[model samples]
Target: MASNTGNAFDFNLFKRLLKYTNPYKGTFYFVGVAAVLLSFFSVLRPYLLQVTIDDAIMPSDNEGLVFYVALMLGVLLLEVISQFLFIYYANWLGQEVVRDLRVNLFEHMLKFKMKYFDKSAVGRLVTRAVSDIETISSIFSQGLFMIISDLLKMLVVLGFMFYKSWQLTLLVLTVLPFIIYATRVFQKKMKVAFEDVRNQVADLNTFVQERITGMKIVQLFTREKAEYEKFKGINDKHRKAWVKTVWYNSIFFPIAEMSTSITIGLIVWFGGLRAIENDSLSLGVIIMFIELSQMLFRPLRQIADKFNTLQMGMVAANRVFGILDTRSFISDEGSREVGKLNGKIEFKDVHFSYVDDEEVLKGVSFKANPGETVAIVGATGAGKSTVINLLNRFYEIDSGQILVDDIDIKDVKLKSLRSQIAVVLQNVFLFADTIMSNITLDHPDITEEDVITAAKQIGIHEFINTLPNGYHYNVKERGVMLSSGQRQLISFLRAYVSNPSILVLDEATSSVDSYSEQLIQDATDKITEGRTSIVIAHRLATIKKADKIIVMDAGRIVEIGNHEQLLQQKDGYYKKLYEVQFMAEESLRS
Candidate 1:
């Protein structure tokens, strides 16, 4: 339905949408039954009008006219009641269907992996959750009902008119081709217009969210004017989409009105001539024809509106389904059991590339024994973090096998593997909630004592006590109320609460202030006691006490030794990195 663009409106979306109506079988049956009765009653009105005009009023028969008038009133009463019932059931079904659809969409979204989020914008998801569902609901509430009502009215009216006079019926229908021709032209253009507009609006929404979230950074850098101009450009694209949408709607609506109006004009022009020339057609029959004409054309116009709405909804469905169909890049069959691990890990012939164009980790291999601490140091993007990612199985390697306790990692269930290792990620994430709830993540069984014990281990117990509300204090969205170091401390506490066999810290103290850094380091040292910890760090001075330091460059391990042993390799990269940090430290002390 995309005009010269030649794209077809996805009819399958409508098919899927109707499945919701399957549950409302009683309502659907009622609509059909009421429609038949309503249409049956509609024909009676025209017949009663014909009798009243041609026989009762012409002969001035009062008793007969009164009885006919009573019949007409009763039919009117029945039609009104049926219409009310029809509208009620239609609305009830529409709302329930929309409710279930939104629930399914959100549930499916939760099943998607982290990569889906990396590729999709938040505003686009939000629009699908809200706007897209509403459009489909509108189709049910208005479109479905209108289609049923109008088509039924058309069938009843046409049958009656043709029975009364085929000549008049044919005359009325003669101009329908023009209406169809005009509607066909606009429907295709209008469908494309709405789809383009919806996509543009989604893009605009995405831009707004990105800029708003980064607004503080913009102000800090004094890039407000430049940001505004960038925003203005997106706004203009959205505006163009809107202009085409409104233009098609404006032109289509008036033209449809004129087309329907012309049919009525033709009926009046011809009907009046017939009545004057032959005195065969009655005034009541002409009036009935006029009423039926309006009912028929009205629903056709509504169909056009529904057509536009369906296009927008289908575009949204296409985007939503595209995500639903995307397979999680990292997943396990979860059928294999490796039992419990003894924390012995070895990476064999590992190779990986986030983008296929360039390798990040290539043919990397290392091993660590149980209860031993391994420190990883490298310049950024030197495959240091990549090693930890492999340990957690966040990404599947292209060609490699990682062994835990001499058992292959691929054979272990993801949950069984993950539960054993506690990760304190670099960018800590906290929900919008109270401190106690965030720490526990609403586990339902976690006690305040458990929270305190974890906080105590992380050296944050005193900090929480100093707050006015203690552990009950609000963390705000993403813990924005707290400093970066405080957030890191809480995340460390959360990881500690897990009490796992392996601890993976990704540059955990990089953002902490010197005083906070020392506290976090002390807490980290205590937590790593008698456990396996593979740590990634930027500041080389902190890892001096590490059992073994693995210096990595590009995608391979270049040196593996104790701090003093590595430093003696003056010709190596590790020694050069050490001297740079050592000089910075000496300058600070002086």
Candidate 2:
């Protein structure tokens, strides 16, 4: 996203966010109430200064001084107590808000259609979900709290100062507009700077994630030096952004300090002249002005800093709210009226694209019987993947009707719709948990037997047996602890565990060895015997055994037949693909 979505802060999004954290109203309200109490205690410092000058120092009465000193001490204790409450609540609220925001953002992201992920950059998503939300939490917790309490303290102090002497108070008040103007200007610049900072951070994060994931490739190709240089470039960009942010901070603080200092100097000069004349000005009034002037500085500094924080946080808020603002392309009416599917699928004249500039699947039409293996074969970017993606309602077709058992797939609730189907994509994602837990995805109250059953069926039980912990072995993030083939098999087992009515294997066996592939192929056939199965593959051997094959080129289906029929059409695209694969296999055999 943009700096500010639609140029308005979007209160509706803010309200919706509050709904999730509203369960913690006790903590939120306590922070607010504690802040007001802190403001009340802040007003007493000037009161103490006035009493010391009027009752003790001015008249030289040591007897009355002790009582005032004790009173000041008591107020100090109250201030301490209030400050404690403020700190505790603000910290608690900050961490809690961050937790809640992360949860909400992730939950919303998961609910989105696959097309949303396809369009989003992982780096940008991480920035908004993590650092951006952190900025917002800081603002909501401590920043928002301090702004209100300090503003109230400033107002109360101003009232007290004016009552002591309106003349000096007005002189002090003259600097108010300058502070406000400076804050406004500085805040605008800081917001823009921090936005760049966030982007640079995202660039750097992407570099790090890619480097770590591709460490093997970098090592094998001896490209570490080149990769390091590329990484340093982004890292340097991030450094410059952070440096600029510091400079903006440096300028705002001093300017604010100097303005308040000038106001204080003027007040002192006026107060001193009045006292020399021995006019109505008492020492108490002069001392009070001095103390109040200092008090004004604290809030002035706070307000200036707060404005800068608000600016930086606005970028974060906008990004977070932007995620919340996104309306998924495919929406269910929440009317979970559809029951189990009948396995019949129809794609009628579908036209689709990831972006409007180019279409991926164009005017594709097909039908699948209840229990048939329909294999799709195409060159990369020729719309083989797009066909299954449409079936899953990942992207809404520009124009088409995808009927599942006579009901438009879009009409079914997303959760209900997805739960009825299982997909094993080319890349598998395994969690950092026990193999059993990963198989069940930590489904609560699920027994180990449920996992063992799926494992045995997918032929991964033998592999799990070799591990020391067996079912208890932890699969590190993305299953890094397992070999590629093992991870693939475990993923297959996980899918089989779900027992979905419609099974989609998108190059499922492409990563497996021949022996494992055979075992999986046997399992696939046995399991999908009376269910709908769709396979997308480039390997001609795999699909040769499929009941039907659809040959596609450039988003359109050019031919369709059983294995033998496509071979008879010798001049077609399928024949060329078949010949290439056959030759490759023959060479391997030789």
Candidate 3:
């Protein structure tokens, strides 16, 4: 939850938001000029009515009446044109600013360390990137620019009223202080409500996103009813938060209307009495004062509303800037340029933990020479996957050195280092895109021909060709349209196309069918050839041909040897793990 300090308008936040308009300064300046012109033209309509009533109709001058009527139409036309420019340009500036902001925010998020994402919610980040940004746009369109135009309109109306007659102008403005006081109170209450609304919206998004993503688990465990109740509770909170804003609006708008009505009543009573007393007092002045009073009070009321938009935008800005200001990036100060070298990997005295004081990898050390395949086998929570994460530099090691090709991994450029390595996790994630696009990841350098060639080399090309669109087949969200094994095959093709010097298979074939398992094994042989490979698997038979086997238990390497040598030690951890973990799979395979 983000804190809201209850300030309805933060001038610092406003200034920071204004900086994003630097790219569209011409549009911003044009909108400002339009606002000023709009103010001038809007004030003329009432003034023209005053002139025509006083100087043309009363004196029965037909020529003067015709001229004043023409002038009034011209002023109305100019006001309309000014309004069109103000609206069109202001919104255009807002859209352009937010588009750039969203891009910058997403790019910033991409640089964050894996640890940051581990502690954050995908739904909340999505809310910040999409929904929160949209609200910021409204700050410029409905809040800031509109408020300025309205304020200008108010000032112009007040000036004309005073010039016409100060006594009546003063009387009409008596209700202003009350209205202003009411507005201050309304703004305070609404600020709290709007903040609550934003918080609840984020909560709702997080809840729905998580629940929908994990809906399979909910149904598998027969917990749908329970989850529905939880969702309803969150949905109810969202409803209540918005209802608070509605309550504030319901109470405040009528008060503004009553203030405007009271001002008009006071002007009518006093102005009528004054006109009766002084024969020179014209009806035009009274009518004009009524119109002018509405103009002044209407904007005051709208400012209260617009202030909510501005306040919401500031709240959103604070959240967004909070992400942008985070210094939790994995420092990439290494300047070493990656070039062709023997694919050697070494983890010397590596110690790491995902959380404070809870080590998951404890002084573990290993070496895989060029063209060697090292199989890491361990039970769940034995830190098998942690080793892969460290090798890829997804999380920084607390204290240790990870060297690749005789160079410390931390001393190499992150992009260059990762570019030479490829990982295929147990849970393969495919984007909602065509199969060809997913395989290439939209990389222009890796063309359709490259993908087809890679897929053919891996023996999945025939299966892909049987599909309706072949390479162009759309793998819907998370590749849900394809079976689990089929998705894994697509991942293999993706990795093969990258042609990395080092390949990692993190239990890649753990859950696939026998046919898919055979396909993966063949593809694995082809891809891992002439490269350093690390295979993290539970199936003992699949890794029997590896150059070395490293068995881990409780973050420590308990055994290190080839399949035959490790099996020779009857009481060793590797022998025990092989018996327990692979016995069932071996039986099923036979």
- Model 3, 437-550: lDDT tens digits are 888898879989888999999899999999889999998999998888899889888888998989988756656888887887788788888889899965555579799899
Ranking by lDDT: 3, 2, 1
lDDT of 1 by residue, 1-590 (tens): 11233354556666766777888888878877876777677677767787787778878989889988998898899989988887777778778887888898888786565546767899888887887777767666666665666677777778777887898788878876777677677777876776777788788888888888778899999999998998899899889998997888888789888877888888788889888999788777777778767766776787677666656656655655555555765667757665446789898888887666578888888888898888998887789877877788877788888988887878888778887888877888888888888777776667889889878876789988877699888988889988888887777777777777888887555567987777677678777788888888654445787788898999888999878899898698888887787567657757
Question: For this target, which candidate reaches the highest TM-score against the unseen true structure?
Answer: 3
lDDT of 2 at 40: 68
Clashing pairs in 3: none
Q: List the residue pairs that clash in candidate 2.
A: none
Query: What is the TM-score of candidate 2?
Result: 0.89
TM-score of each: 0.90, 0.89, 0.97
Between candidates 1 and 3, the one scoring higher on lDDT is 3
Q: Tens digit of lDDT per residue, candidate 2, span 212-315?
A: 87799999999999998998888899999999989988998898889877977887788889988867787787777877877777787886677556556666
Worst 10 residues of 2 by lDDT: 1-10
Number of backbone collisions per candidate: 0, 0, 0
Number of the top lDDT candidate: 3
lDDT comparison, 2 vs 3, better candidate: 3
Task: Please say which candidate is ahead in lDDT: 1 or 2.
Answer: 2
Instruction: Give the poorly placed runs of model 1, Cα more than 4 Å off.
Output: 1-8, 20-81, 337-340, 508-511, 539-542, 586-590
